[model samples]
Target: MFHTILSQLVGTAIALFARVVTAVRGVWQGVEPVPRQRVYFANHTSNGDFVLIWTVLPPALRARTRPVAAADYWLTGKLKTFIGREVFNSVLIDRNPQTRREDPIVQMVTALDDGASLILFPEGTRNMTDQTLLPFKPGLYHLAQKRPDVEIVPTWIDNLTSVMPKGKIIPVPLLCSVTFGAPLEVIEGEDKAKFLARAEAALAALAQEVAR
Candidate 1:
């Protein structure tokens, strides 16, 4: 409760900075809300991806959308720790677990049951690419399979990888556009591979939209 209040306060300040950066650079955001419980999946690129999307989301929806981040990377230091818990309200998952028994689905299922939306990067790890969107892992497909009613929305963030790669500290403000594609629903008896393919295809379609 205290964390949420603090987050709303800090998030507002961050959003203002993002607004100016996006506005001056002519960034256009196309945002739409899904009525049912949904999973927002996007291309992984940079550290800025979380803030960029969070800033553009509507105030009411912002609190509900939790970004699933890498535990090892984002959980370091006091400031990152605070923001991860408070500002982003992210689900810190162990992407590269030493044990073969590691699973994100268990935690994801719990969150969905609690009626909160999720933001996931299907690639599992950040892929710094421009021409091609990475092949998706089955994690997203599994999520959709378990929660078929969930509105699985595929999104593309143009130029984010280039705007700020892993090592770079400063982000070169570009006209980054958040392109949202139509939601991909899991049809009855849909195979996991096909569902995963559709998720990738959906992102590819949106990436092409941004290129146009």
Candidate 2:
């Protein structure tokens, strides 16, 4: 009961805050926001990227979308733990595990198998530069291989890097747009490096669209 109430409150807060402070605009290309099993991948610029993405989603869809996050960061404090588990329904993973047996991919695949959409940061960490994006990590490729049927969509969050630049706690009020590009295609038996490169290019193209 408490978790349900917290989730509702968090939803309301994000809806209002996103509209009032950020004036966030959402653009969909080649696909519309609907209740579909998908993996929404994006470039990680700020710690709040998932929040912003979750905020922009349509309410019903928002309820079903879960953000993939790091357990160490979100599980550190009581308030954060509640928000991460209850509010956002995040699939928190141990990025730096002590043993090789601890795999984040297993967690992500489990979420997909349970019929939940995911919000992922392919970059793995926050970017410090002004470039469109840093190189994407291999987790995305592995995840794709695991869940081949799920749609992989490339999303870009513009101006977020400046809104809450890395290492800064306070967010600057700014206008940012979240553009959801078309689903990325998975070729038959594609190599890891080649697939990752294509995925990076797809996101970069969306960023370019935002710039225009």
Best lDDT among the predictions, by candidate number = 2
Write model 1 residue lDDT over 60-101, tens digit each, in one string. Answer: 877788888888887799989888877888887887667425
lDDT of 2 by residue, 7-42 (tens): 789768867886776898888885799898889999
Candidate 2 ranges with C-alpha deviation above 4 Å = 99-101
Give each model's whole-structure lDDT. Answer: 0.76, 0.87
Worst lDDT 10-window in candidate 2:
94-103
Q: What is the lDDT of residue 113 in candidate 2?
A: 90
Name the 10 consecutive residues with the lowest summed lDDT in model 1.
22-31
